[model samples]
Target: METVEFYNGNKMPVVGLGTFRVENNDDCKEAVKHAIINGYRSIDTAMIYDNESKVGEGIAEGLAEAGIARNELFITSKLWLADYGRENVQAAYETSLKKLGLDYLDLYLMHWPGLDEAVMIDTWQGMEDLYKDDKVKNIGVSNFTVSHLEALLAQVSIKPVINQVEFHPYLVQDELRRYLEVQNIVAESWSPLMNAQILDDEVVKAVAEEVGKTPAQVIIRWNIENNVVVIPKSITPSRIDENLDVFNFSLTTAQIEKLNALNEDKRIGPNPDEFSGQ
Candidate 1:
């Protein structure tokens, strides 16, 4: 229900539904629809996720059922590594748009920072063109390191409004977060719950008990308290609803410190610098 404003003056819901591995078309569609009907206004998907059509289907159903207009929801998708060239970027964007059955995306991100800086630059330029032409509401990068951002920032004409990454209690990404803050770019967390692995942490459990909330809620609140955008994915209707029930409670300063202390500089996803996109 809370929103974060981009430098461009567009607002994004602080919490969203992430469709990373929700491969079952029926389940993905249902999850998206359910999330929207239950008060979620943001949805995150990607080209590599291969469920854009289903997501599009869900969005249509959710809008019609919820009685909300297309502008009421924020939809995001990504550009894959294979489509990382100036010549290929527009076609890739078009393909994603066609699949999603939407004329434009709320946010379009570079899925990864690929191995070559030149390719990244070219792809970003293509995205910049899309932004200029009103093809996408905003542009950003995912799984990008500070060094990668430095490279992209030095060469690009348009600055990215956000950097989506694998962020959670164990993977806080302090340096990258600081840089993004300085650059006035928002930070979005992909695996905010660490695929539900963080639910069993002792600290998370303690906080959940104290706050009378679920561990998932505790972790989500932590992200919110830190001003990080979180997208916790779920197909189960109950869990999906539970994930969004984080706005009511506030984590005490000490509890937030405890959660922050759990950071080990760990990562569950591929490292951007070394990932070959295979």
Candidate 2:
């Protein structure tokens, strides 16, 4: 698998498995196991998803069966909105670590910017503490816009190493991507396929057909081509395998431009600025 290096010299797999709505413990466990068995080196989960234990179970099982060691896998989880303070954040990570059955995380992210500036600042402090304490290998944020990042960077002693956000052909987030690039922070795409909406786009479909690849493959390739990490969720074994099959083909410059032209600022998830949590 291709990899991206964090500013702190940690390596992350360029592609990973995302566990979002696989709410069932058994299913999430199986999905993680199957994904790892199929050659995925990275796994992405979050506290809000409520399946870290199952993901951990699957990781253990997959590693055992695949004959891979613990350090060979990259695992990630996020701090939820409710855990947005220095006091709550550390405990929240501990809860996820216990649930995931791990000593340390490869990456931990602030799940959303939410509505509290002070709380978010405190959360970053917690993240910095976690990193400094060797509880997590790298730290990042999700759904953070340029404004949010600027605010965080202003007060942070350790800059975020990644920004996982809802990015796809329809919501390219060009300016934010540029900012992250200039700062040497990697951009990770959570909804790289836009909840499968891009599968129906004429441009995506045409490119997929021309390359003899699935629309999902085309989209994933587009993300990789743009130098971004992507975690596409799939519970089905075949789709999980298909998502990682992009390494076999490459998208031409014109085809990539065609897909880039599909940006409409559409988003299938909630806006980070307005989300205040339930």
Best candidate (score: lDDT): 1
Clashing pairs in 1: none
**Whole-model Cα lDDT of every candidate shown, in order:** 0.93, 0.92
C-alpha RMSD values across all candidates: 0.7, 0.8
Consecutive 10-residue window with the lowest summed lDDT within model 2: 190-199
lDDT of 2 by residue, 130-248 (tens): 98998788999998999999999999899999999999999999999999999999999988878777789888899999999999999999999999999999999999999999998
Estimate the TM-score for candidate 2. Answer: 0.98
Give per-model TM-scores: 0.99, 0.98
Model 1 agreement with the true structure over 9-126: per-residue lDDT tens digits: 9999999999988994789999999999999999999999999999999999999899999999999999999989888888999999999999999999999999988988999999
Residue 134 lDDT in candidate 1: 83
Superposed Cα deviation of residue 111, candidate 1 (Å): 0.5
